[model samples]
Target: MKQLTLAGAIAAVCGTTFSSTAVLAQPSAQAADQSEIMELIVTGSRSPERLDEVTASVTVVDAEALQQDLQLTAELQNILSFRVPGLAPTTNSTSNFGQTLRGRTTLVMIDGVPQSTPLRNGALDVRTIDPAALQRVEVVKGATSIYGNGAAGGIINYITRQAGEDAFNVSLTQQVGMNAEETDDTASFRSSATIDGTVERFSYVFNATVDDNGVQRDAEGDIIGQALYGLSGVRTQSLFAKLGYQIDDDKSLSFTANYYDAEQVDRLIDVTSSINDGTKTYAVKPAPGQTFPGEPQGVDGNSNFVLQYRDAQLLSNTSLTVDAYTQEIENVFFYSTTFADPAAGFSGGNSVIVSEKEGLRLNLESVFDLSGVEATFIYGADVLNDVTSQPLADVRSWVPEMDMSNEALYLQSKFVIDDWVLKAGVRDESVDIDVPDYTTLRMCGANNVCRGGNPVEGGKLSYSDTTYNAGVRYNFSTAFSPFVSYSQGFDVSDLGLLLRAASVPDLDQVQTEASVIDHYELGVAGRYRALNYEFAIYESESELGTATVENPPGSGLYVPVRAPQEIEGWELALGLTVNESLELGTTYTYVEGQDPDTGAYIDARKIAPPKFTAWADYTVGNGLSASLQWMKVMNRNRFAPVDPVTGRYTGAEAPVEGYDVFNLSALYSRDNWRVSLGFENLFNEAYFPARAQAFTYAGYNTMGLGRTVKAGLTVEF
Candidate 1:
């Protein structure tokens, strides 16, 4: 649909301009593209293909690197952990909880519609939307049933903003920030606007964003609390619109709508700490002027609607695409005592996840040549209807109202022959759930002990599967080009975190079935002229186990254990242009998972350790630019807080002992005004965020986010 159109459709769809999309990934060989130049992915084959014809491993974070991640942070989980690279890291709260990507469980989307509530996975689906209404982001690393069900660690979509050629126009942006050490009541503000154009065949775009944050502080500056999901005094708003028409000339039609809201009205609280005496947690205020309790958590009223249609032939070589969507969300959590119930008069409680979804997608693509290879085919059909529930703002019923229905059918194929590339796919899922027998109350966690009320005995739960995939590639030239892959995924992930901790009296003894992930990958990429590179290694298995266990000790409540995991990882990306205004890059990721039967180390609450990103970019031309970035999250010390025969503390094992962060950005424009600046934790060191050194709960140890400064201004009319 219509959105970005700053003059000739931004050089015919983003060849660059609009003050150059806001720099950062500018220059520096663009890291993965290194310099061979050719990038385009419609989430790895929903359409707009390229990237040397896919065989997996795609990153793409453009839109001037999401405007250099809003100059420092606007929290899209810190803009996908500063431009995606194995993700994980970013529990700087509003609930991305343990942000994972390669570590598993990632299936977020915007344009492709689906914002993960995965049947009560209240981790707030990566803050729903609002990187000022995005225009770029696409990750597709592994595991996939090709957009159906939760992608077992892969897929991050989000691609909005379009239509630039201005038959009409308007744009504006503003920013204000705080807490460089002190800034009065903390200060924060943001504003964004965009109106777009094109007429005749019709095209349009609209976006609105507003943020209001304050109270952050960390690198010893104190206050950074809101309990395990804190950030302080939040307030976010976003709205988006798009429309398009062209229906003649092969066809087209589009419509999109989005809405988001965030909450957390902080007056501050939670000043408790005790990593068993190592101390940490903090966030102040509520004592001198009292006030902090109940209600007021995050996300509510999130929405998305989409309608699309495209044809380009419909037959005669075939081509078609259609989509219809409807979504809804309402996550809210953060009342603490984890959910106490001192007998039932309740001392604490907080829960709310009320998902809703209705979907349909159908696609078709075809080409010919078969015998000589050149073939292509992509077939699809999908339908979904979800309705979740989790109740408890006192309305009780921990996770009842199930009701799901899914259906899928898929087929994909591609072949080229000459330079080689072959791929295959298959899918055939069928799911149907329907509960309603409720009764599992009597809470109390965080060690307050209180067990469950049980009564379980829900009904109907069926899942069927037939996943498969295959891949191969070889362009062979410029040193390397290899590729290999295998994929499958079909999960019913957070069954409301195991039906509200059911004490199982029947739900079929609650093992809940449904999980079939299996992924394997291997890779190689090339370029020597300016050095481009990519390397991959992966393994992912699942006989069950997707992890989630936190029995008795420090119970921030978690449940679901089937054991039998096997995760593995590897990644490396390097880019170097060294000329053309300077560029250089680096990336590294290493993941580890265990427990194929007591091999241990499978819980850091879902594995993460060793990550790195390095960057450098420079341009001296008249409209100046600058960039620098470095991040690290090394060290790992799996287990041993006290478990020598279960003496407590297995709270997802602890000891991450890692930290490093640095950032800086700059930009300047010579016309119509555009100016920017950034610096986020750019050397204020004082660490602690690897989920506050590996999660043992207790407000997640806190700390991380000091040194801040952002400045921005933009105008266009």
Candidate 2:
């Protein structure tokens, strides 16, 4: 009989198994020591466990990997696209539209504090925190309810840096880069500093970062005007601080605060130059008095505060953890004239959506020796209140304020016997949303005819569901491990959007039902000599999957389509260590989804074509290391035809042509000084991303960035 080893499973989950030499390259001594012990604590696991002991498909990117060559970009979407196999490609904008994981929206968090506004997704959650402020990123694939609502796809948790045992430590980093082809106005600069130390029973870590981005240009030296209004030529600043106090050896308390701000500062207006030859181009014009020059977009401001307490030994073999957090987020979208109603005492400007959340979470875990089997039981409860609203600059309410409250309770048990591991969990969730009576905003049609302002009565909606999951893994030997799992997840629809556009007389009449998703997976992980590999096949089904559809063609009026959907996919990763100085790795991902009713692709733009990524790293001694990486995407012709004029897919489908790119990076470090250089799009390929081509209707058809070079240096004391 062949069984899987914990090591093999961890290798599979990470996509690239790190060799001993690679692990030794970690920056932190504590992390290196933990790697030696093979004890890795993961988010969503409720407790610390060995890598092999984890049953779910989880990917952990440590600080070293996060700073790797191909992942040096400031955009989180770009980094994740190249690293995570199941995630969609980057939209090249601040907004992560259609950037789903496993074809569903993922819940994003920072140190257990939610960043996503599920009540009304602003698509800006992924960019809330600067990558430099993170020590590690954990991604758990597949639908799971362990962390509560909005995890229909999976969860992404960003763990912040912690203070070391040293009395005082300070680090500083600076970088400057420019476009290789057009360097005139395409220069960018970034600076970051960190101070951390441990004194007596108190430990503290503080970090600050500032980034000034220049105009984005393509291979042809043309400015990429299709990007989000506030993405290019923008300034971003982030501040983070964490303080912890050790109360004896069994108890600890921590406080964390983070603030982020991003705004565009360029004074260029977008003027449509041409829309032909399967692409569009925009010229720059001087626009005064405009908030964002080209567009009336505003800044993005996000703030978070958290307090946590943990008791490792409240009782013998028992532990408890509690967390309280509050977050405020405001995201502004590009200006739109569609809602301009001068007759209604309102002139359309940029619209902004605000979301505020306050929550408390509690978890308790206990280990019990039951007969001959060792079991670990975990339970937790969560209470959260979210308030969200969308309003125009003219003080007109586009979407009225909505208050939502959620309560959840979950219980999980894990048992280990010999070479077998069994796990089961269940969660009960309750949700309530309140909407006040209001009149719809007056809107003008394309023909200059205005109609709207319909009175809608206030209503309240409540819903509840119970989800369950089970998994079993057998480690038949040190060479291989195989596992099977079934899990369920649920998400309440975007209530704020639903209520603001509600036409029904009563809330009960409207479909306020939550969508339930079920996931099934079979996976195998194995190690042979210096080679490690993992493969998984999975299927997800949702009876009431949500899809966006254009109700009136060319009118831009869209509505949600509730239909049955099924998605199936497979993932494979391989890693080989040729020697202590050289290593190679590769990953392949394939996913597809279909609507059960019409048998057509559901949200074609959301589907990522088959992708393959390969990388090689080598150390040349003298504290120097270099790496090369390549990524290729296969052509996806599985979509309906597009309308010539509107550029909208007739059946919610559009082709995504494929492209490949190469990258190179080198690093040199000695003593307290480090230097690094990275080259992106090494081949200077002139191509467009799938989203850019598929969304030509919005005049967003633009080419991707060309070859670029970046260099940075870091100093520590």
Candidate 3:
């Protein structure tokens, strides 16, 4: 019997080295909720077994169903893409913190901390986290013996919120909502506290959150002009803290800190246009910029910060975990320019770009069962440092600054038998690019004066790679299970803006770095008693990630790649419990991408069509509860990109034909106070051309806001 279950986990870690109640009962001695949590421990089995015997494919989100769906909004990737299922949520014109699942690139954490911030240019935005400070949201779809190498698209843990066995507890909440053209009016407030008993034994968990967001328009309420959405009344403020120490229990320690300051200001659109009679010279308004002398005219700021440390052990049956972290970010960009027609003349100038970043990470994990042939292991290291500076107005002939750095080391493993479960991992990363050295002078025509060039100093550019993953799993009972996996990921390129636009001349051994995908995935899942399910199918091929790429130097001469991409996908999820007051959930996703060089296909990767996402709730007896949600995105054929000199198609087309959005929520709790009311896009679905892009100078297609109404109220103690 698997060596008598590894000898009862080595007699419960040798009774936790002479028992302290066997180390506070050894993390619930295995199973407790979420249908017995599918017997999984040792995140990729560095030792503790039973995640259906491991073969990889995990996704558990249930902290009382995410605190009853956060009563309405806590974002978190729009509540895990409407209740997780092959995750998906991208393209509302890109970069809303970016979240992609089956399509790859996934890895978010909290508790096991580390919210990626390699100098702020990759993976982030678990919808600015706030599942009311989380208590659960596992998800391990793919890649891991235990996260090594940016988890190559899979693994999201946010299990915060602890301290229960209650001795002292409190909670409070507030809310208000209005949408369906009420103009995105909403409000929120929260409070929580929990303190268990015992002072000589030790146990504690503390959490905090404060959120406020409002400003969304579309369904004719205006604003939604796309391209990262002109900022919009963006506002955000967050703070999180965790402290744990249990000395007499075979070892344990935790200290976590989270700080996020979100800022938004998107209401600036002017993409070239001029006319004062002479027949209006062809429409297209807003274009007359050139200001940034002292800054202050529609500001900009992006921030990030995190700190964590975890140490755990259980010698007897084998289990150990260790992690260290440090992350920081500060990115600021401001723009406004003028230089189109000064009476048949022009002279450009106006800019402000500043970037700052710092990052460090270290990991180690192990799960044991040697002779019995069940193992799990992971090792890691990461580093990043980035800085950039630019402040200009009108024009200066000097450019060549930005220091970049990156480093990595990784290893992963997994193994199990009986019903089959096996997995593997490998990673090797490196990148270092630093630039400095500049000199330039220009002035031609009407006074000739252009000097020779060759000054621009500071050198150092490096690249390294090696990433891998493998998987397999099978189990025909306990609700059903099936899986398969293969993974690979890489990214690095922006060498100080591609060596200042390769203006030729021994451009240092021309090797603009390159690396892209060749991914494939397949899956299945199970759950019974009130039902639950999951599904997946995927294919990826890339000549380079991000398609074609180009949109760095002076946001003009545009082109965000679009000639080599092939994506195919599928996803579905469901949950039901229709009795004792009702509870239901649903999810669906479909993706398609193509271009393979010109077969054409890029309406923002088809805006994740194949829709249908559902949610239902009922619990009316004293404390009240009500919920409803629906979303459908399915309208293919949206293509617009083909004007290599008059081939016409000039942007915005392809099939923006899919749309459906609805939301309704209500709740009222008694004890610690809670009140929620939500109503989003409920019959005001007006999402114009989903993902529009075509030399965008802000000429439309950033739609998808329409109706929004939210409310909140929370208090716990």
Candidate 4:
């Protein structure tokens, strides 16, 4: 029952994000009247419910906090990195390669529409939408069956911004940034426009953001590489629009669309360096006769559309909601020698993943009595179609096209008896996938050893499961509530990882079976006057799970391996509001996972190291406010630093050295104008992030970004 509202999830909660305290710390009368900001839960039950009553762990980053986040960085990965606990840090590139939620893939969504392509898992879902277009973000913790497939960890939903009560409103923002380590050719720019209005029964909101980035450098003033997991010289643009129509007091309809694109423009080649040599890779301009190869690496495009209709009084006390959605996305990866075949006519190769999804959801909620105890029942049916594939651009097929159809029906019951609240839900899901006969592209590692490119007979695959969830909460007093929960999640877990590396003669011989995760959680929440707190512990396990492993050791050919795995973690959050305009908060998080059969701790690629985060914000009534945030990742020594035989730093076995970072932001607003200034990586700490150290790859050991500054101005009319 850690159903703390985004505004109340405070810093004191370990999994609570920084924005938890920010919403309540706003310069508003909310500090005096706590009830004014009581947020309604949406993603928790797939319906609007009271935050304090939801029987699950959820985190929300409200609008005010999202605004504060934008002032600091434009990257969505960076926004979620320090804000959400349990989630791994950003790779600081176009890819979310190592970021995970509780050591598993989290289904990223926009308005209940899935964005993750688990079939191929390009790890680009995190950046599909811009914060400027969203009103808030909701995170549901632990395994879940709410939104079927790829939710082994949980879900992150980005709620679109809304039209305010104002009859008409418009806001424009422009900002520029540069690396503090060195400024030459390092200036970045961003601009956004938002318009919203309400007219009688109609309301609409539109937002657009354009971002142009420049060369990025580490604390040592070396240009960050562009070969892999690099962010330098990229351009990103986001467009979002939402229109709502109220047919009557009891019925409404809405349509939403969002499109995002990012691509590398600047020409910079990576100067590969070895982890064994204790050297960092850096980017450099090409020489006079040198030229780039392959296609520019980044997101080619991502588009999403959703249409929703609701009736508050469809029949008697029953309510109904229907949703329709469509999505398409393509993620392009960097050119690498990992897919090269020296004996063939290939030098090096790059690949891209294309996914298209269409789905429909129908839900109904009814109120009734269950044996004299007040109860509510929610029932829903979902149908989805997804087609995904991965292929080397203009070359050959890697992962053949997989057409999938999914159908699910679920029912949830909630009972309220005096001071006790109990809830349970069950979902029956069926999935069918068809793959055509194809040949796995031949690939060569750095050692010039060839593998794959064999013809595999394809056929139809079917999966079905019944997932269940139950939880109970006891509200003893206004200050304390504790809850226990159990849930299950089903996922196919990167099917393409298996298909592309297929040495099997046929699809039947492959381990294409789905994975089911069992999740358990116990948590408590308390609020005392101006202070709020939350604490939770969780465990997730699977009989057949998947993880990225460097096959054959030191081959640089990473593959997903199926194994029995278990993950456990705990979190705590605390927030204190001093008077009406000052707030202080902090959180601590720890997570770990292992293979039950081998009894060995998982690699850092999946599990995040322990973390500590703190923040302080103050509002000066005179149109000025400032906030400072800090984070520290603890040392992760799960594996040895070097290989026993080669004396080389083993991939994914390199020891991870921890580091700390700080950020500062200040904003001033008067009349119709607002100005903001922010600093990232305050004090310019020169260090490698957890993933960079643990990855132990030639070009992936890049350093974290150096100190950076951003200044922006906004005008309203």
Task: List per-prediction Cα lDDT, in the order shown.
Answer: 0.76, 0.73, 0.50, 0.81
548-599, model 2: which lDDT tens digit per residue? 5555554434455688778878787777778888888887888888875677
Q: On a 0 to 100 scale, what is the lDDT of residue 667 in model 3? A: 79
Ranking 3 against 4 by lDDT, winner: 4
Of 2 and 3, which scores higher on TM-score?
2
Better of 1 and 3 by TM-score: 1
lDDT of 1 by residue, 1-717 (tens): 111111222234222111100001222355366343466668776877767777467777877777866877888787677567677777778877677877788888898888987777766787888876787877787678878678888878889989787688888999888877766677888899989898889999998988888888887888887765786788888999999999798899999999998887765777776454467888777767676567888886798989999998988898899999999888788776656787667787778888888999998989899788888888889898898898877788778989999989898787888877777778898999999887876776656767777688789898989887776677777557776667778878688878777676778777677788876666677778877777776777788866667565554446777776778777777778789898878777888877756777676667778788878888878998888888888888877768566433546467778788988878888788788888888888888777667776666778788888888898887
RMSD of each: 23.5, 5.5, 23.9, 5.2
Shift of residue 398 alpha carbon in model 2, Å: 1.0
lDDT, candidate 4, 1-717, per-residue tens: 122232122213322211111111122122212343356758877988766666457777777778887888988788777777677877787778778888888899998898899888888888888789998888887788888899988888898899988879999999999998699889999999999999999999999999988889899888987788588989888999999999999999999999998989887988887666688889988788877878888888899999999999999979999999999998888887667777887788778999999999999999887778878888999999999998888657888999999999998888878877778888899999999999888877766768877899999999999998876777766467776677789988678878877777898887777899977777777667877777787778888876756666654335556788888888777777787788888777788888878877788768878888888888988999999989888888777545576656666667777899999999999999999999999999998877787877778888889999999999999
- lDDT leaderboard ranking: 4, 1, 2, 3
Model 1, TM vs. native? 0.34
The alpha-carbon lDDT assigned to residue 152 of candidate 3 equals: 45
- Cα lDDT over the full model 1: 0.76
Model 2 misplacement above 4 A: 1-37, 69-71, 226-230, 271-277, 281-299, 345-347, 554-556, 642-652
Candidate 3 wrong stretches, greater than 4 Å:
1-80, 83-91, 98-217, 226-412, 419-431, 434-477, 480-526, 533-682, 685-704, 707-717
Shift in Å, residue 531, candidate 1 = 6.5
